[model samples]
Structures are given as structure tokens and as C-alpha cells.
Target: MTHRVSELTVAESAWCKSSYSSGEGGECVEVATCAAAVLVRDSKRPTEARLCFAPEAWAGFLQMTTGH
Candidate 1:
């Protein structure tokens, strides 16, 4: 049941850029964690739609991406 961060929720979110992001900042993503979901959005266009993931799905994605 993942969904984009609504205007109301966005007001309460604390987004953080990826640590691996370059200082030049060509393109990167930002993430915010909520009580039951993980929110991801492009740093360049934050006002655009975001991609949300359930906690379990997010953990699985990290595992696959990190090859851990």
C-alpha cells in the first residue's frame, strides 16, 4: 500500500540526500522515512510525484541493490 507523499505529509517529512551523491549534484534522489513507509523523490524536481515503498519492500530493494 505504497503511495506518494501528500501535501499534508510532505509538510512533516524530513528528506535526506543519498550519501553517495556527488558534490556537483548532476542528478540524485532524496529519501524520507515515515512510520510505515519510505518515500523517494528526485532532488531536482521535488514537487513532482514521488515513489513510495513499504518497509519490507524497501529492505528487499536495498538488499538486492547492495548485493548483500
Candidate 2:
């Protein structure tokens, strides 16, 4: 259920950069969580389309990425 950021009312303060993101600006990613979904966007282009994921699906993605 991915969607563009323009479709949601996410606050500016809700966005956080990925812990692994380097301050140098390469591969920067940001995530914002709400009651219904987790939002993912490119930190460098926040006005662009964003990806939305169900909470459960987001958990699975984290688990797979962490290999745990």
C-alpha cells in the first residue's frame, strides 16, 4: 500500500533519517510512523513519492534486513 507523501498529512517532525545513513548525503533514507502505516522516503527528495507499508510488513522487512 505504498503512496506518495503528498497523499498523507505527515508532520515534518515525524520524519527521521535511517541510523545507517551517512551525513555525507549518499543513500539517505527517512522513515515516519503513524497509527496505520510506516512511511519511507528519500531524505534528499522528500517531496517525491514515498512508500507506505503495513506495520506487520514493515516488521518483516526489518527482520529480513537485520538477518534476525
Candidate 3:
């Protein structure tokens, strides 16, 4: 079931903007929850691209990206 992040219920899914992204307009990234998976999308071209990952993968990605 491919679900768009925008279509997700914000109340249930905690949406967050990447700390890496600042006031810069060119770079924009957002993430939200979907019970079983994590949803990611670009705020710049929201409709252009999006990706999903499992809980473990998302955690790994965060660790890698954040250098933690």
C-alpha cells in the first residue's frame, strides 16, 4: 500500500523537518510515521519524489546521516 506522506493523518504521524535543513529553500526534507514504516519527502518538490523505509532502516539512516 503506497501512501503519500501528505495523505497521512498528521495527528497520528509525527511530521518533522530535518535538522540538517535550515532556512535554505533549495534543500528541504520531511519525515513522518506510518505505523509500520517511515515516510520521507522533499519539501521543495513535494510531488516529485518520496521514499519509505522500515523502522530499523530509518534508524540506521538517521544514525548515518546524523553521524551519531
Candidate 4:
């Protein structure tokens, strides 16, 4: 199965760095949520490519990672 994710500009999305990231960056990630999908990108490389996750999948991943 194939899923489609809309490519969005940084300004277009309300991007926020993960709270888990520290000032001294080491493997940091940023995320933004939209109507269609959740956007994720490397905090260190703001201009790089982004990975999109479907809303349901994103929520499931979060729940699993956080052990909720």
C-alpha cells in the first residue's frame, strides 16, 4: 500500500524541536503536525529532507516509544 504526504515548507508548518533535545545537540529531531500527516526532520539539518508519518501511525509510534 502507498500513502501520500504533502511536502511543506518550514514556515508553512508550525515546527517545534523535541523537548527531549538539549541545547548541546546530539541526534535531535523536530516535528510538526498537520491535518494530513505528521512531519519529522533533523533538527541539526533544518534544510534537509523530512519524513512524513500518517496520523494514526505517528500516534501509535508515540505510544509505543513512550510506553503509554
TM-score of each: 0.80, 0.84, 0.65, 0.79
Query: What clash pairs does model 2 have?
Result: none
Clashes of 1: 0
Write model 3 residue lDDT over 5-53, tens digit each, in one string: 4565544246677777767576878887768678787877666656877
lDDT values for all models:
0.80, 0.86, 0.72, 0.78
Per-residue lDDT over 1-68 for candidate 4, one digit per residue giving the tens place of the 0 to 100 score? 33444444446458888898877968889898877778898988977778988789999999999999
- Put the candidates in TM-score order, highest first: 2, 1, 4, 3
Give the 10-residue window scoring lowest on summed lDDT in candidate 3: 4-13
What's model 4's TM-score? 0.79
- Model 2, position 1: C-alpha lDDT score: 62
lDDT of 3: 0.72
Task: Find the candidate with the highest TM-score and give its number.
Answer: 2
Candidate 4: global Cα-lDDT?
0.78
Q: Cα-based RMSD of the predictions, in order?
A: 2.4, 2.3, 3.6, 2.5
TM-score of 2: 0.84
Give the runs in model 3 whose Cα sits over 4 Å from its true position: 1-13
**Tens-digit lDDT string for candidate 2 (5-26):** 5566779999999999879878
Number of backbone-clashing residue pairs for each candidate, in the order shown: 0, 0, 0, 0
Candidate with the larger lDDT of 3 and 4: 4
Pull out the clashing pairs in model 1. Answer: none
Q: Worst lDDT window (10 residues) for model 2?
A: 1-10
- Strongest candidate by lDDT: 2
